[model samples]
Target chain A: MARIVTFFIMLVFWVLISGMFDAFHLGVGVICCLLVAIFSHDLLFYGHPDLLWVRDIFKVLAYFPWLFYQIVLSSLEITYIVLHPRMLEIIDPRLVRFRTRLRNTMARVTLAQSITLTPGTITVNMSGNEFTVYALTQKAAEGLPGEMETRIARALERE
Target chain B: MRELQEEAKLRMPWQDVILQTSVRVLIPFIQLFGLYVVVHGHYSPGGGFQGGVILGAAIILMALVFGLPASKHYISENVNKTLSITGPLVYCGIGALCILFGGYFLDYSALNRILPLGPIAWRSFGIFLVEVGVGIGVMSIMLRIYRVLSSAGTIDQGL
Candidate 1:
């Protein structure tokens, strides 16, 4: 019931957004919506939005761009280090674990993805709110869950 | 162990809910945007391959947030099966058509006259249909892969 309503709402929203009011196109859209609905109807009732606290959602959005910038910088640094001939001498691959204060699954996943995107660090395991990370250098491994951790916590309102 | 069980408790079951309200409401727009991507692929950065992946990802997101069963209900196995074949079939058919027109295989420029439009815009219409075919094929294959992997139990248990 709720799924059907959501589908109709989405269909109407799509029609409006696309300005596709032609009978043929609208008919096709409706049919496709029904088809998709028939297949996906079971998805209507699983997760609850109650877990998401919107108060911090926007904060994370704001933080993401900055995080992306850091990711780019780190990627460049890693790329340069990898391209350098003395890369093996510089490489100090080690695994480090740290407990994060961020409580939300979404925040943790985002943080993990960002870390992986940064090139030097790869998130191997996240268990019991503890993250196991593989870092290329000792310097890179140390003090993690440091400033970035605090920033993510702030963004997620985990504190 | 307690924490793990508690985390496990956080997992929702089938019949716990129906379809995703957001996906139901948003799919039309996503599909429309996907169509746009398919149509404009030649002139822009996105081609049939990229657009198809995005479309599949959107549906997958709907499946993840909603439920796999629900997504299957919406997309269906038969349709996806046909789609998987359709991409290669279309590519091959187009190539054959080009051969019939006394051109090389897969030369889409030969089909321009089929639309009754201006001089065959090979980059636009020819590439557009090929892209659409590719998108449909890729999307179906990806969805099938998701189904196979999700059913394997490891996806949910490990994640």
Candidate 2:
């Protein structure tokens, strides 16, 4: 099975890279590998139905660097808001729901996680096509379902 | 022969089964890395807890690749239950031992005299064991929660 093969390849790659082939430590490595194999069996077996194409995998990977940049930018903005004396006057917190175009579970989950990582936006709840998001500012909430939803839709090729 | 072939057909796909085997093969190296992280946690950026989770994740990864049944075959539910309890028991036992030596609960300094070794020499080992226990408890509980919730189809269906 692909699952078992992936597990073995990952282990072999790890051993080759880590060079943990010492005599006494070999037993420990074996035990650890066994545990990994035990836990990860489902992923290997299922192979993520949502990730049917290589392009989908690449798309998800490509989103990470951009997501990190967004996180940094938002963190700085949050820091500035926190340092300001009249922070409460500029900040508005409320829950707003919007529909998303992404149909795949993985893409939606990634979007939620990405939004949560960014300051000023927190995903409160998600049900079907609707997402309840908490935003610190209305400006932050304005494009709620547009930019992020578009990006995730693109990543998932779901339109 | 036809009936037997049909039963085999009902099993998971060949690709998935291969992936599961591969994941199992790879577990040894990931585990060693986890151990390295655990042992050097105090001096480096990681610790026992991180390593333990990584180790657990490796297994969980295999489970994801293989079917739940195969994964359960590799790591029985009983073993998980035992590990879930054993970690806390070990931690508590260590604390009790410290108390017996007339030191505060979890005081490692008191353990030196009991072990026929120097205090500083044994303290690191004591801390290492404690961290292992904590890691085991946390990892088992997290995995168990995931398994239970997923089996109940609550989280999976919601996703």
Candidate 3:
């Protein structure tokens, strides 16, 4: 079942990238996709992705817009900080550590990546559920693993 | 013996749960992109070599984040060896095949005699096949280099 889904996913991706409708091209794409599916079908869903994954995926899709908004907001804030005459004072860099309730590995990593993606903060180290983040200012530092953690939890948490 | 095992566990390769999970989630897409580059080489800026390196880097990224044992477990010695060997064979085999068809070495259009795709199509396709071969070869070799260097010619845990 997972293999079939993987095959279709690879096929769709192949068609999208190949951009060819010819029978021969389609045939080759099928062959290549089949090989990939056979080799890594188990990997596509990561350890028996159950029916709940559909819900999780849709949840993640919905989370993207909010994440994008955060990215834009952070970028604008970073720009303001850089352009300010008192940039050094504004850039009060500090490392902050916090524990997270998110238990799922995928969820935790998503939070970490999202945090890093947003400007002004970098997820420097993560041990177990604890994230060691570096932020350029106290304002940025205050938001460490805050709403992004909750949104990702909503998106990826299994239970 | 028990003490040695305990010591090994104490110094077990640093496993950041975030890095491991992130690498796992990222790997399939990277491999897919690598395949895309290999197949698209004819019309694009990249060909087999670049595609192969990208493919190889996915595994290298795996090794970097997940450690040697996990990497080795995912891609065993036997599988790696076979992939490395098959690449060159695919490359030279096509060249030899062109020769058998009474064409000069690496002359792709000569492959038209085997399956009558038009010469123009064969010429384009032959390059794709060679690129695939190169991609496979380069990827495997790149992985081998990393594995050997990291382990210092030993597959066991080492400094």
For each candidate, give its TM-score against the true structure.
0.49, 0.51, 0.84
Error of 3 at B30 (Å): 1.7
* Native contacts recovered by model 1: 0.09
* Model 2 Cα lDDT, one tens digit per residue, A1-159: 554554564567556644546653455455555655665445434453343555776887887788788778888888989999999898988778777777766667677777777888987655556677889888778857666667777787654
Residues A46-148 of candidate 1: C-alpha lDDT, one tens digit per residue: 3443334455557878888888888788788788887999888988999887888777665676677667777678876566478878898887787476678
Model 2 agreement with the true structure over B1-159: per-residue lDDT tens digits: 354346446753342322434464455556557666764565566776787788677666655775456556766788989999998998999999999998888888899878766888668768877877877887677667767766785323210
Candidate 3 CAPRI-style tier: acceptable
- Residue lDDT tens for model 3, A1-159: 777777787888887877868886778778778877776676656677567877887899999999999999999999998789988876898888899999887888888889899999998766677777889989999977778877787788876
Candidate 1: stretches off by over 4 Å = A1-57, B1-32, B35-159
**Candidate 3 deviant stretches above 4 angstroms:** B1-14, B108-121, B157-159
Judging by TM-score against the true structure, name the best candidate: 3
> What overall lDDT goes with each candidate model?
0.66, 0.68, 0.82
Best by DockQ: 3
lDDT of 3: 0.82
Question: Model 1, residue A29: displacement in angstroms?
Answer: 8.2
In candidate 2, residue A112 scores what lDDT? 75
Rank by DockQ (best first): 3, 1, 2
lDDT of 1 by residue, B1-159 (tens): 445346446754322111234455456557656655554565556877877887887777767766676566667778788889999888778778878876678776666656645545563556656777888888888877887787684333211
Q: What clash pairs does model 3 have?
A: none
